[model samples]
Target: MRRAIAAAMSRSKREIPHYYLEHSIDISKAQDWLQAHNAERTPEQRLLLGALLVRAAALTLKQTPELNGYYTDGRFDPSSSVHIGMAINIRGGGLVVPALLDADQASLEQLMERLKDLTGRARHGGLRSSEMSAATVTLTSLGDRGVDSVLGVIFPPQVAILGFGTPVLRPWITDTGSVEARPVLRVTLAADHRVSDGHLGARFLRELTRKLQSPESL
Candidate 1:
């Protein structure tokens, strides 16, 4: 596993030209929706914010398709399906990303349930080979660890990786010029510069923010 990871990182560093974009999104609506949704569920069955972020990314990719594919053989190949590779940290140490198949088609509740199942299976070394290799794009979050932001490395063959930082309460100016404290989340995307430009990256972030703010759609 160590050799495989090292080889993959070495290939990514040597081959991919990575460009990063960062944005802070107001997730107040998403938070409110989550809190209310969880009120009727058991503690073990409640949703995690990371799952919502994944759902949002999946939805964003439907519009910004350039960021959701692989780069290989000196060209970019866009994927027709959106299988999100969710990064999960093992209990003892190390990390693994298991693909959540057809994330864009799942309902919010179904996505949360699938995420819980994936994380549990990944930590216990129960992931299938197809799950390990079928990811069209990846999502990593260090928010639970209290990191403010991250500039992630692009995992190769895959053209991009989306990262989420810890959510914090910050003063936000409303359209009416009133300042209010809102829960803001920092999101970053690292993409292959050969396949996409900063303009597309910005558009992707905007769509992601829009999806996150309208959590009802996820």
Candidate 2:
């Protein structure tokens, strides 16, 4: 497993011209919405913040299609569907990203259920080949470990990886010019320079933030 990871990283570093863009997303509204929404559900059926982030990214990719595809054979191949790789760590060791096929078409409730199932199966080594291979883009997060930010390497064949950090309380100004502490999530995008640029990356992040702010639509 280590050798395979090392080889993939080596190829990623050698072949992909990587560029990174980071954004601080205000997730206060999303958090409030999640809490209220979860309060009405059973504990096992509740939504996770990570799942919400994945949904947001998936929806954003629908509009910014360039960031949701592969770079191979000296060309960029755009996928018609959005298959997001949700990175999950194994119980004892290692990690895997099982693809959530057509995530953009799923409702928030459906997405949460699928994400829970995928992570559970991933830790138990129950993922199928299609789940492992169909990822058009990847989403990674270190929120549980409290990492501030992550600058991920672009996984080969795929052109981009979106990373999320721990959501922290930060001072924010409201529309009425009032200051308050809000939950801010730091998001980073690492993409193949051959397929995208900083402008597109920033736009994707902005769209993602907009989606998160309106959790009801997710």
Candidate 3:
């Protein structure tokens, strides 16, 4: 697994003209909404912040097709469906990224359930072939590792990858001009320069932020 990863990442860096962008998103509203929403539910019925991030990215990708597709044979082909590759680490060895097929269509609760199942399967084996190869884009996070941010390499064929960092309490200025400590998530996007530019990437991040801020809409 390590050998395979090294080869892919080496190819990604050598062939893909990578461009990166980072955004500091204030997720106070979303966090608060999630807290309130999960308060009445049983522990097993509650949701996770990662699911919300994935759902937002999947929906945002629908509007930003250039960032969600394959760049092969010197050409780019955009996918109509959004298959989000979730990066899951194995217990003692490597990692596996399995796609949550048609991620944009799933609800928050559905995404949470699917993510749990996928993560378990990825660690224990039994991942489907389609899940292994059908991803249009990938999402990875180091939040559990307590990292401030991460800059990921673009996986081959796919044009982009998104990374999320740990949610930390940062000083933020509110709409009313008061300062408060809010949970801020740092998001990074690594895209193939052959298919898109920094401007488009910035727009994609903005849309993702909008989707995240309006948790009820997602």
Q: Identify the candidate with maximal TM-score.
A: 3
Candidate 2 regions exceeding 4 Å error are none
Task: Give RMSD to native, each candidate.
Answer: 1.3, 1.0, 0.7
Candidate order (TM-score): 3, 2, 1
Clashes of 3: 0
Score residue 109 of candidate 1 by CA lDDT.
Answer: 79
Candidate 3, 1-218: lDDT as tens digits:
89999999999999999999999999988999999999999999999999899999999999999998899898999999999998899988887889999999999999999999999899888799999999999999999999999999988999999999999999999999999999999999999999999999999999999989999998
Candidate 3: where are CA atoms >4 Å away? none
Off by over 4 Å in 1: none
The C-alpha lDDT values of all candidates are 0.89, 0.90, 0.95
- Candidate 1, 102-142: lDDT as tens digits: 99999877998899889989988899999999999999999
Residue pairs in steric clash, candidate 1? Answer: none
lDDT of 2 by residue, 47-114 (tens): 98877888889889988888888888899999999999987888867778789999989987799889
lDDT of 1: 0.89
* Residue range with the least summed lDDT across 10 consecutive positions in model 2: 86-95
True lDDT of residue 197, candidate 2: 95
Assess the local accuracy of residue 167 in candidate 3 as a C-alpha lDDT between 0 and 100: 98
